[model samples]
Target: MLLHIDSSADTTADSVTRQLTEAFARTWHTAHGNSADHRHRDLSAAPVPPITPAYTTLGRRVEREGFVPPAKVPALTESAAEQREWGLTLPYITELLAADTLLLGVPMYNFAVPATLKAWIDRVTFPGALTDPDTGESLLRHTRVIAVMARGGGYGPGTPREHFDFQTPYLKAYFGSLGVPPENLHLVAAELTRVDVLPQLAGLEELAADSLARARATLTALAAA
Candidate 1:
């Protein structure tokens, strides 16, 4: 099964990242048809709850004491609030563990991922959740990840703002920590998406169009792969 995660704050019509991801999902569904299952989680429309202090404490205690089934978390904690918080966040982890592919529709917000996406990351990233506690194995080692991102400015290699591209590196590191090797992760970016609307970027429209076209083509091929 594949999990499609959309974190774009803009409507689908306005969000380049969303367009790419949706195209990917359509292509995947067409290629895999009845053979694969697909699920979508929109972080923008229905945001994941922020990790509270109680949730953090519970997660730490669970890690120290060893992993337990989500249903068994109540046995590890007496505080109802902690249990409730665990209940809220455990589903996200569960979905990740069950997915064979993780499709992330992310857009650069202030040179980084959207805050809602970060909250989702924080909620599901507790130790023993993405990693096996007994064998120290990475649950995501075999999972494929495709991150479709959009940026308002050019940040590719040799670009003046290349160093400002925190979105890609941060995601690469985040997935790497979960045991997804470099080969299993695919990144497609549409840069300078604001060129058409901003007078200062008027001459960069062709670059933006080329970037978007390439991103679309890449997503099409990757979805089939």
Candidate 2:
């Protein structure tokens, strides 16, 4: 299954990250002769709840104390709140595990991933949830993952604000914990988005379009791969 997750609150017709991810996902379906099993999650429309103490505490017990039947949870005691939170999160976890590939649409807001995306991540990721606590094995390690990102400004290695960019590196670490290596985790990103609309950088409109095109092409190739 192909899990396509979009976290951009920008519902504008010109939302680059959303366009990129959707195009990539569609290309994947086309590549598979329209038989691809694609699933979608829109984080912006329905945001995920942040981690709570009940969930965290109970989840830790599950991780440390170990499980009974379900590998996702342990055979430990829990409060009603924790169980309720678990009830909310288990379907997402199950869907993620069932997917063979994941396509994530991430827009850099304030130099980091959007809060909606983070909330989803917090809900799905906890110690031992995507890993084996007893053996220290990564359960989701083999899944193919790709991140489609859009940035308003340049934050590349030589850019003046290079160090200000946290989205790429942080996501690499976040998904890396779940079995996606730095190599397996690919990012097809478009930069200078603000330049596309701002009069100050109107001269760079062509450059922005070029960046978007390159990102789309990269996504297509990766989806095919």
Candidate 3:
């Protein structure tokens, strides 16, 4: 199954990043049909809680000893003790483990990712959950991630603003820590601000075509493999 997480908060009908993500999903589905099952989470529309003190405490226990704290145990009263007695971040971790591919649509916010996306990262980045405690083995195995991001400014390689592109580097690091190799990380960025002066239909079409082509090629390769 594929998991799609869209973090763009823009609700405008013409949101470039969101539109591109939706288009990617639609194209992939059309190409693959029932061969793939998709599970989607819209972080901007329905935000999950940030990592809380309670969650942190529970996470620490799980990381250190692979167990949940006793105090937090009673809070999970609705389910069987064995099933509901873990840290709050366990569900998110499980979700990551359940997916074969992860498609993330994130917008650059002040040169970084939005807080909602950061929170999602925090939830899934638990030590001993995605990584090993001793040898630091990645528990996530051979999963892949495709990140589609949009920025107001052009920050491609060698650009002055490239140093400010923390979103891709951070994501690469986080996913790498969980055992996803560099080759499996596919990134596509749209520089919308560069189109402000041009404002021409041809320019927009060119950008969209390039991005869509890259996305389609990557998805097809992944599906075939």
**Winning model by TM-score:** 1
From the highest TM-score down, the ranking of the candidates is: 1, 2, 3
Residue 90 of model 3 has an lDDT of 69
Task: Please give the RMSD to the true structure for each candidate, in Å.
Answer: 1.4, 2.0, 5.0
In candidate 3, position 219 carries an lDDT of: 53
Candidate maximizing lDDT: 1
The better-scoring model by TM-score among 1 and 2 is 1
Worst 10 residues of 3 by lDDT: 76-85
| Pairs of residues at least 3 apart in sequence or in different chains that clash in candidate 1 | none
Query: Residue by residue across 136-199, what tens digits does model 3's lDDT show?
Result: 5665667778888887666767867779898888888877766788887877777653455555
Q: Is candidate 2 or candidate 3 better by TM-score?
A: 2
Query: Candidate 3: lDDT over CA atoms?
Result: 0.70
lDDT of 2 at 145: 85
Q: How would you encode candidate 2's per-residue C-alpha lDDT over 42-136 as one tens digit per residue?
A: 99888888888888887778767553224546345467887787788887888888888888999999999999999988888755667655676
> What's the residue-level lDDT of 171 in candidate 2?
85
Q: Over the stretch 1-225, how does candidate 1's per-residue lDDT look in tens digits?
A: 889999999965888988899899999988899568899999999999888989888888887877665666778775989878878888898898899889999999999999999999999987577776668788889999999999988998898888998999899999998889899999889999999778877899889999999999999999988
Regions more than 4 Å wrong, model 2: 66-74, 133-135
